[model samples]
Target: MSQLYVAVLAIIVAVLLAVALYRATRVKTKADYLVAGRSLPAAVLVLTLLTSWIGAGSLFAGAENAYKNGFAALWQPAGGWLGLLLIYFIAPRARKFAQFTLPDLLEARYNQTARVLGTLAILFAYVGITSYQFKGGGDVLHLIFPDTVSSQLGTYIIALFVIVTTALAGMSSVAYMDVAIGSLVTCICIISAPSLLHQAGGWSALHSSLPPQYFEIFGNYRLSPHGVLQSPAMGLVRALEFLVPTMLLMLGNQVMYQKFFSAKSERDARNSVIGWIIGTVVLETLIVAIAVFGRALYPTGEVAQHPREIIPYTARHGLPAILGAVLLGAVFAKVISTASNYLFSPATNLVNDVFVRYLAPNASNKRVLIVSRLAVVLLGCWALYQAIYAESILQKMLWAYTIYSAALTPVVLAAFYSKRVTAWGAVAAIASGTVVTLAWDLPGVKSLFPHIISDRDAIFPALFVAIAALIIVSLFTPAPSEAQLAQVAE
Candidate 1:
């Protein structure tokens, strides 16, 4: 029942998973391997979306907010469900468009300039997000081990595991692995949630033992009127930060779009979004509970302790040894599967959309696949290094969402809804959004612009400016020729 033994059990599960995925997937056809042959059934697609979306970010970040804010923290996840709602309406259209990545769709909708710019935007966003997951996995591994294993070494191992698996079969491998991990994780969460509550002495016990503010929605003024700016707490702003990125997620981005591509049909893709939304509502609530309980159980002042460790710490003490061990493995499964799936998407996009299409349009699919595998290694290394140097788990998740949303969301949305969007518009939107967001931490910048103004205005302003420029320019300029217009309609 030692934590060390529990940790060992988790590693064994991951190893077994790797071996099983390696044997099950024998990649040859690019379509079959990179995207599950573009024929994923509803069941597999649903579960994979569920697993891929809810990584350490949900478990750790959700837990952190729950720990810090109590029941009011539930609003954090409520925002994500809103995102899933948006996805349901948007996904089928994306799939019907039949593209490799979001940028692929934009290229068809607008022009090559749009495609190229969107691709660059996603690369920055995804790498930043994936890097955090890399860092989180490494941190978790180091915590699972001790003196015999250094944190840096542990990070490298987890990073390697992710990079190697992603390189194996692209989305094809990520999908099947997601199904298994998602199901296992679902069972673990169901088991762990109740036990965590029990350790807190049941719902009534948890309800009464805390500060009076624990149960309030605005416990810390997070949702207050002033929350948008000049507020003492991060409540409203945090919620906005969570909301805007998720809104973009529902609109653009390859991760969700790929799910749409892999769906058996339009119905399946739409249904999967609803299913994921439902699951997010339930699981996020459960994670929030675990985080609150964890807060009460393990306070500060340990040699090594942080909020992300809350789930593991509580499971080791609050649940029976065997059940705790199983849940622990599920935690790792959540982290690794997400890392594997996310890292693969951008790599594939880079090779197929940018490298093969622009660099050498006539390159065989086989060669493109090989290049994709290499991109996975190169990107994976970048993510792994950042993961080691990064702080706790939640920040990385935010980093990626912020960058991607600010850059790609506008351009992605423009593709589907705006007929006037042009290549120049796409380029301008990406450049403006990225510049504003990246300079967010600058000294004079914050004072001049401030997080309040800078945050809201950054992406949205860039998006609108891009749209206006595209419309004005396209009006004066000739529209797409009939042939290009045909491609756009398709």
Candidate 2:
């Protein structure tokens, strides 16, 4: 059975690589390499966005949440659904202001200092995101081939695959391949859930066998010895910790904006959000359902210790041979698609935002392409280093999401809507948010404010400080110049 799953995954990857190489032939200029030459249609944009958003983060971290807390895991994705409603309004605007990277928007709306600081924050957050995709891909690989591939080697192998694929054709490969992977995974997940539920002897068995709280919205709290709920406050707080980061990431993700910029038109970009919202809500709910059902069948053992493996474990061991193979292959391909998108985004940032902008303004097309591929290699290595020390993909996912949410989201959204925000204020906001999020998670800093920072994640305090800086500083300083405001007014 494991061999069958391996064979299926190998074939899927080969097909994807073939497609990537074919696309590579078309990537001649920097625009073709970075944004698919700004030619993606609505359907392509929809699937690519779905694929990038629902990667290892949803498959592993979110599945782990459902395995442990049941249906309550919906809270994590609910945040994104809410954000998508807002994105529907922002997508066309973002496309109209089309540029290669988010830092470009920062520089146009604010100043070069804001651009540089935003690039740093994006690297801090995105490298962390790309790191866990490696870890998650490694987990899926190690789960199936445990006898031969250790998790550590699995991480290195997956990282190399992603780096090569991303460096091959850039967005041309990542965006189009996502259409295939996203559609396949959506169907597999929707079909697998009910089948898994029926195999587990139905929902009645799940209800009877699992804890009652598993069905509840806030399923993460504990009970007292006397059987009373003891930590409702903490449980709600925990849910918010999951909720905030996801909402913020979706709203301000550079990957998403870059995808929008790739659209054929502003209409294509706007239409894609509608498809993305529906696909995201349905697929994410199915993922939580599949994991919840998996928990019922394999209630203990290895899955209990490492709940993130629940989806793959159930697919390999609990489902029928053919279904399991396809499902596992879908998961493997989804991880690759996401890793390529994320790894490519930061590479573009370094090249377009920094290298071309400052270091080599007169560089040729061939030179820019060379630098772009090298940037992918260097950033990918950094993420691989993080993957080596990372114990929990869920923890890393939330940490990265919080950093981007607090540091970048506020400023990104303000750029679109608020003309009064000055360049200095944008710089202050970005710096404060980035610093607070990074510091709040440090061992020494958490030890100092255990009450406020111990149980909670960094989004709350960091976002507060960021918003305060944007508002208070902008009011005291002169408003943004008319030219600066016009830059983002599209």
Candidate 2 per-residue lDDT, tens place, 1-490, comes to 7679878988888888898999999999999999999999999999999999999999999999898788889999999999999999999999999999999999999999999999999999999999989988898888889898887898999999999989988999999889989999999998899899998889888899889999887885444324567577767777888898899999999999999999999999999999999999999999999999999999989889999988988998888899998998898888898989889999999999999999999998889999999999999999999999999988899999998999999999999999788888899999999999889878999889887777667888899999999998888888888888887787
Tell me the spans in candidate 2 whose CA falls farther than 4 Å from its real position: 221-228, 231-233
lDDT of each: 0.70, 0.91
- The digit string of per-residue lDDT tens for model 1 on 1-490 reads 5665556565756664675467335676667656667788778888888888888777776676677668777765676777677777777776677656776776776677767777776777777677766655555655556556665776687778888777877777788778888888787888888777777788677767766667775565454444442443555655555556655665565888887888888788887877788777888787887778777666564412566767766665667877877776677777888888778888877887878777988877688778888999998887777776777666566666766776777667666666666666666666666666666656787798664654442444544554455556656654554554455352
Cα-based RMSD of the predictions, in order? 3.6, 1.6
User: TM-scores of the models, in the given order?
Assistant: 0.88, 0.98
What's the distance in Å from true for residue 400, model 1? 1.5
- Identify the candidate with maximal TM-score: 2
